[model samples]
Target: MTLHRFKTCATSFLAPFILAGVLAGVLAGLSACSGNEGANYEYDYPTVSSDKFQRQRLEELEGGDETVFGELSIGGPKKRGGAAAGEGFATVNYYLWRATLETLSLGPLESADPFGGVIITDWFTLEEEPGSQYRVTAYILGRQLRTDNIKIALYVRPKGTGKAKMDPHRASAVAEAKLENVILSKARTIRATQFK
Candidate 1:
């Protein structure tokens, strides 16, 4: 074959493979660039407009009565049972959470886990005794607002000029028990009022 014809033949033979390689590379680049954009796309349910959903929720809550918006519903067994069941499933016991907070009001809260039902408080020092501080950890054991459903751990340490370490001997069981009693009492009071 002539040199010009040979060159043209070679070009035509290799063109399709080169074009395929370039197309594959472009597709790979586009996919890498779009990171996780389509991973959470839900095809089953159409997205609701936030403003319209909020307006509908407000109308349901208002229920054509401005004065009764904030009032707790009171009536026969059917009304009370459904509301109570719905509230129970949605979250942990509110009374126990409130009582725990109220009891630990003096201490600085470090971490509160609503899902795991754990509350940790930072070191709290008494005004009269600056040399000592206390830390508390409260655990909400169950959804029911019962005394056994709540647990507390109290740690006491003697404050030095440097970092204070907990002394096991200085820890008072009576003080911890007293605090637990107080929390349980408050929880009981809150539960009573809630049922009424």
Candidate 2:
């Protein structure tokens, strides 16, 4: 009974303030909604003349008619097939370099030079050719992902021999050519995946 009496007295004392707050809120909302949108209004800032740089920028923005990155011209898209801003121009073939590294992963990597496009592998023997340990040195000659721009040299050391030379039987010139072909195939695959 005491709690009920306290709640009733408190609500009665706060009723006038709550009603005034609700009345103020309703009036504010009605006034806001009754804006004079029919009244004409204009920006008061003075117009400024465009300089040469401003005109050039406006022209560039307006002249984006080329369809790029498979997107509409109105929206910005990635520029294809070139170095982006702040990046140095690429001189070596990227796909060829990646493909050579991937194909030579059979052996332990000794050295890899991306700019110079040189890949070398340490002497390692495959399971099929346990008697012959092989080393690979690949050179990407140009900025093209073509077969002629890439070169591969394979050296084989037979079991019990201290020095290593081009393989006589296992990894000969034929094997070198085959290695180049493998790298080329991998490059093509990598290029395909990138496009997709």
Candidate 3:
């Protein structure tokens, strides 16, 4: 083929590819700009308490005293319930701790598997009130709550020197291997009978 004809054909074919590349570059630029705007969107959630409980939770987590095995922390429950059918109503106490991903080498918990990010908690105080700030800790459940992006579920149990007992089922949520109950409350407590 003559040089002129060959050149014409190549230019025509390359035009579309070049145009596509330019279009893609423009789209990527716009996409990045849009994402930056996302940072400007404010989030609204209940304000995290500045109380000692919250402070202690962050302090222990940041102090590097513990490590999470997967998606767990060793503390007490964040949610509470009334007494069970057979058991009398009891007031549950909780203490929380926090840790950073770089420190614990843990990842996001909500992604299919939470236990992947675990932190072994240290004994912190659960203040039921004056003289009642008992020492305790446990495995915590971690999930990226949209606002803070890092939230851990405290699975509390009886700690050193504390006679107060947590429902067996609540304890199992942390101890069991297979996920028997996604909702922590629904799982049958190991029951006082199992302990005996």
Candidate 4:
């Protein structure tokens, strides 16, 4: 084959493959950049400790297992050792979980475990107060629709500019209590809708 004809055929054959590779790289880069954008918030909880009662309650409810709904098959055929039909087993209080997520929608969710009934949010800075940020960890104790079934831990931190260091602080008792009340109220509203 002539050099000119060989060169033309090679360029035509390789063009589509090269374009596909470049497109794939760009798409991968974009996805990676956006995948964990919620994890960008920075904060630390220094003195906060996990609640023993909550942990014990969760263990009891979960039957010491981390899987949701314990061994029950959902939306599919029954499995061995699974809950019987009409048993109505659930991992967490759906009302409380939904309410907590809606209340903390401003923050980026870091982790959520429905079986453990825990929702953790990354530090979120208020637009009006750039120097201050807050993080939240919420626990839905059980399936019961009760006020006491929900628990929350709120953490606040003040960012320092220049040479100053960031210091973490637990939100005030009153503020924490207020947030809990807000979540509970929202839960009630959501639960009410189910009946109507």
Give per-candidate clash totals. Answer: 0, 0, 25, 0
Q: Looking at model 1, report the run of 10 residues with the lowest lDDT sum.
A: 64-73
Shift in Å, residue 180, candidate 2: 0.2
Better of 2 and 4 by TM-score: 4
Query: All candidates' lDDT scores?
Result: 0.68, 0.71, 0.36, 0.73
Per-residue CA lDDT of model 1 for 1-196, tens digit only, reads: 8999999999999999999999999999999998987588757877799999988755533331111112332321112334464342223355677789888988899998765668899988988878788889988775566667777788888876554464523367787778878988897786557535
lDDT of 2 by residue, 1-196 (tens): 6999999999999999999999999999999998997999887997666797688644433332112212322223424344552133224566777788889999999998765668899988899978878889998876556778689989878855544445434367888999999999998787668634
Pick the TM-score winner.
Answer: 4
lDDT rank order: 4, 2, 1, 3
Per-residue alpha-carbon lDDT of candidate 3 for residues 63-179, written as tens digits (9 for 90 to 100): 322322321333322232343311321211111122232222222232222233333333233445332222212233332211222333434445435355432113333433222
Q: What TM-score number comes out for model 2?
A: 0.51
Off by over 4 Å in 2: 1-90, 161-171
* Colliding residue pairs in candidate 4: none
Model 4 weakest lDDT span, ten residues long? 61-70
For candidate 4, give the lDDT.
0.73
Candidates in order, TM-scores: namely 0.49, 0.51, 0.20, 0.52
Whole-model lDDT, model 1:
0.68
Q: Is candidate 2 or candidate 3 better by lDDT?
A: 2
